[model samples]
Target: MAVNPPKIKVLLSANERLQKLKEAFHGKYKESPLFYACAPGRVNLIGEHIDYCGYAVLPMAIEQNILAAVSVNSSQTIQLANTDPKYKDFTVSVNEITIDRENPQWHYYFLCGVKGVQEQLGLSSMTGISCVVDGTIPASSGLSSSSALVCCAGLVTMEANQKTISKVLLAETCAKCERYIGTEGGGMDQSISFLAEEGTAKLIEFNPLRATDVKLPEGAVFVIANSCVEMNKAASSHFNIRVVECRIATKVLAKARGLEWSSLQKLGDLQTALGLSLEKMLDLVEEVLHPEPYSREEICKILGITTEQLSKNILSANTHHNLICRPCVS
Candidate 1:
């Protein structure tokens, strides 16, 4: 007999505020006949800062996710509420694409997703809706809690319209929406959340949509440690700076080799265009961008970087430390 997939219960909590909000909303919106959808947060196991470059990423959807209750309105305005104490009531009109830094704070991220879907579908106006969001993931540990919110909002909106949506299209729309929020993160998080199967991890390659299943090691427990650090790139410009730097590096290398950088679709393509091995390409990236220290010195020289600058640059990148990538071992 074929076994049914095990049921997973998602817990909603923002340090205890979510429970109260859930109860309050359940009472207030109970008679409204709202529709609900969920999208989970993700943990990237490998390939950090490499997804935009067309490298493979290993990511898994966690049990924690954002549960959204949505009800359509007659007007073309979107209203949002978060179960957390930090977030307050916010409203937006579909015709306007403005970011509000102050009030109705939680809606900003979800609105980006809506904007992305709208732009992709060429819709002049979106169905006005009110959404109540409840999240279970940690705030800023790099587990992609923000992406989850965007995707869940998009899913809720699409379902409310009774539209048939594909998982791939939803993932792409969510990824595009994230760009509106001013973060140039890869599409790995949204893609993984939509595509990942329970009890398995996925290796995702962005261009052309290549995904492979990666079996989790037996008896292994995946633990996400909260660092109590809330770093959002929207407020600080550091994340944008890194994105610009990467673009610059790609352009420079492409010019040096007499090729158009835009034509280079994958990280592998960039490596081939530059005529550099994986180790050499990584070393070159480290030498110029200097995001982190070289785990090995011999690898640095092979890519044409002096040892003196390597250590200093790597140490500098370590100060903002939150989540470190741990390699998957056999």
Candidate 2:
């Protein structure tokens, strides 16, 4: 199996969206675009919130995706524009790519992808790019719109700069780089976005990134329904706090089990250490953690660490140290 995204030579005039995006790029920059890149969003098929624990997650790429028409330029700034007017245009110097985690804007997500590729390729300097982005994925709808945007941007930058990267490497880099926008998540979204193939889902496992294709049962029908609630990851500290709580909880459970708790970050890590089942893990949780929410003081006491260490190692950029939450979601 090829580990790289397939390169398709496009007949632009034939594909409607490509043609439209090309025209839009020409209209905006007064020049024809050089190339286009696309990356799909994903849907978790079975489970989530456990991939970070070194557990495998089942997810599949969706039809909706983020697509961009891009061209290299002598100008030293990267320019970004969206098809939707609600998302404002943005530009940044090629050498000065900063992601504003405080604002959590759409452009910052794209810049996260670009910055990720920049770091991966070790390019201290790169030519500027002008890109027109068009996305069909609904934002904040559990469709991984944000991760897809980042992956699309990463692919676009790599192609425009004439760099080569494997799909797995791209997925891993894109996963870590999404932290620029303050989304503290595992690589499930980015993995499935880049690693998934048509007509099959993938079991994405991290900490050495591997993807295994899984064919669905014959005639199994699944419907994806959005709840109309926007669960924006980067904008919400609660999300990261929940992640931190889980991390801390893993430590507590590990210490109680007479295992090294300090280095472990996910419950999956703890489970793997002792080789326990999900039911056994739950039993351990019931025995170790009380019904009440855990205070930061209590967590520190158990871990034998100071608040500074917790913030430095466990907490995410947007999450606060005053975090007092359950170690596991009830």
Pick the TM-score winner: 2
lDDT of 1 by residue, 1-330 (tens): 012112244465643544555565666556343556778888889887677666788999998888776778778888777777687778778788675533224578888777777777677767788778888888655778888888887777676555656777778778877766666666888888778787889989766665688999998898888788886655555554454444435643554456765444345567767788888876765554434422334323433455554333321232223221211110
- What are the models' TM-scores? 0.75, 0.94
| Structure candidate 1, residue pairs in collision | 293-314
| lDDT at position 104, candidate 2 | 92
Q: Count clashing residue pairs per candidate.
A: 1, 0
Q: List where candidate 1 sits over 4 angstroms from the true fold.
A: 1-22, 26-30, 100-104, 261-269, 272-276, 280-330
- C-alpha lDDT values of all predictions: 0.66, 0.86
**Candidate 2 residue lDDT tens string, 85-169:** 8999998999888888989999999999999999999988888999999999999998999999999999988888889889999
**Lowest summed lDDT over 10 consecutive residues: which window, candidate 1?**
321-330
Per-residue lDDT for 283 in model 1? Answer: 71
Q: Any residue pairs clashing in model 2, and if so which?
A: none
**What C-alpha root-mean-square deviation, in Å, does candidate 2 show against the real structure?**
1.7
